[model samples]
Target: MTKHNNLQSISVRIAVKTPAVSRALEEIVSTLDGFEQQLDEKATQTDVLVLEVGDNPAKEFETVRALLEDGVVNQVFLTSAKTTTDILLPALRTGAKQFFQQPLVFQEVQQAFVDIHKERIAGEGIAVEKVSIKPGKMVSVLGAKGGVGTTTVAVNLAVSLNRLYPEKTIALVDMNRVLGEVTVFLDLQTEFNWDELVKNISRLDPAYLAKALIQSAPGLYVMPAPNSIESGSQVSSQVMKQVLETTKNSFDFVIVDAGTQVGASAFRIFSSSDTIALITTLSLPCIINVKRLLGTMRLLGSIPMNNINIIANRFEKKSAISLEDTEKMTGHSVYSTLPNDYQKTLEAINTGKPLVDVAKNSQLVKSLNKLAESLIVKEEPVVKRKSWFW
Candidate 1:
């Protein structure tokens, strides 16, 4: 890709047979600047593809697939009146980057065009240098049960890590498929989420990942989960693994909030994580669930006991379930204990800020810092191995 110093417009190719779809594209193109429409035959020369589903949806999908497979087009925008799963699923499987229903919204199409423009500009400046990328440490935070403060630990831990290592890049991923609340905790208003990335997982790279991330802090980026339940279910294990692999390559620390529900995607993330923080409290039910979770992990053998860090959240000195008993039951030592500071924790949650920022002197913040330090220490060995052994 060559950069044009006086580039005025982005070239777009439309291949829709549907009259309504063609009109929609024409209207969208007319309203947007730096965008020029091209004939369908110019697919090889255009920067975007607006392919509308016709009488034969399967054939249209195949056309899209072939264009992508042959590298003739990098961006494909699909339009369809039949938005049923039968049609949409196959269309997406064919590597269609975006979908638009009949009577396409200008705003949606405009955003897609903007993304293409940004991607093109970024691609033009790519150098041929072979930069070494050390795979980052992935830490998956799993809750024994719901309402166990799993998100709290994950969010604060990520913030603390970012603070501790000001020069390193840190990302926090909310892997909770159905009910992820990481964005709410951080008070981030994100226009794009994991769903958008999953739709184009095949095109994922450092640049694309960087665009998808929402900067919650100066050095901390967050990939929030989908807002709707339907979109959440679409996040397959394959997509999760791809996202984690890409993120691990791009950042120094990747903290994932893997909510209580354990599914195929959760298992894939668990297997990839350098440390799996199994969060629990002193409650008996929580301990039992933790024990069961450990048994399941042991059975799978993907996550070793050593890598599994048992975290006791909301720890109280006078709790009936002592730390020793909790350890014996869970068959793993408590890696860290967070004091029960209810008011402080609630304040942070309500304010949509990390505990480290809201309650700097809180014991919870100190515990999270300790956790971050441990993770940094663990990463030192990997860096040494990469430098010396590799």
Candidate 2:
């Protein structure tokens, strides 16, 4: 009962104009338990109600005014196909918090709604959290047939974030069972492998975790694959979930360096990740593989139907295929691409250090910085940038 009164200070009412918009909003906000409500709004008193009137920017403006004029509504979100200045500007000026585009990704919407709710409650002196990523980012950096810099990108992303947010606990996981290169990349001799931890996973505790793990850098813990163990010796899917859950309690962001191979264990690990960074190139075969992987994941309930974004690694702008056709062929829009800086990426890998550590401003680093920033802030659609198709 005390918790109930305590939570009224953070109570939020989400309002939608059309049924379609209401349905879309539900896809994300349905998980929020406390005092979150979805109402067919009639311009009445409400706090932090999202007012989304799609396509009609004029109506969106009136809705915002209606919300602003009332003392009840604290924050308003306008979802429209028109995200341009002319349409989004007025809404922004009206103190609207976010401008959501059509065909909304639920993750993005979920973030915005959480932000508004937190702000509304926090303004009233109740504590609130702004953006909460689901504990860890399950980022798979699959090389496009082994030449692309997949592992390099994954390692650097993890290391860079550990450096960027030094206060927060970060983990680097090498999910490649047999020949994981993350151990080599960091120059850390393997003291323990993933197999040892999972072997005694049923008795997993803080002390057990301490013994089974290693620390090579500040604020960074590593879960390296076995030095002598093979894939068949790996822990089962149930054990994998247990390991990740325990890791989440100890770490804020878990960066997985899973190699590009669709195996039972790889699929098992990815099923628990918050974001699956599918690294591929603009080549037909790789892109086709991405399509196949996307379908396979969807079939197995591993990848969320809407969350998978195609990342074009080592992509160049002068390739045979345009980015548009690549998007069309894969049926998933490219999230962002890294420059085809083979030499720079190779140097970083050979040296066993993050590109951000050695070269902060390289084209590859610049692109990764953008990628990490987007993931940390967790705004979508993951910032689709252009590059040459390789």
Cα lDDT tens digits for candidate 1, 1-390:
233555556778887888777887888886766678885562455568888787888777887788788877778888877766567657656766677777666666776776676666657673433457778888999999999999999999999988987767788999888778999999987656788788888778665576567788777899988878899897779887998998898787899999997877888899998889999999999999999998998898887779888988999989999999998988889888989999989999999988877889877788889987885646244432111001
* Candidate with best lDDT: 1
Model 2: clashing residue pairs? 316-388, 317-388
| Total clashes in model 1, counting residue pairs 3 or more apart in sequence or in different chains | 0
Candidate 2's displacement at residue 377, Å, is 4.8
Off by over 4 Å in 2: 1-137, 229-234, 377-390
**Per-residue accuracy of model 2 over 1-390 as CA lDDT, tens digit each:** 113255553334655666776787765665654445635456456556666655666776876777677766766666765555566446545656565666666766665555555544666686544433344445555554564556777888888777776766677777766577887887776557667667666556433454345676877778888776464354686787677766654566677777776777667677777777788878888877888887788889856856565678878889998789888887888888888877777777788877876778787888887787666645522221110000
Error of 1 at 311 (Å): 0.5
Q: Which ten residues in a row have the lowest lDDT in candidate 1?
A: 381-390
- TM agreement with the true structure for every prediction: 0.68, 0.60
As a TM-score, model 2 comes out at 0.60
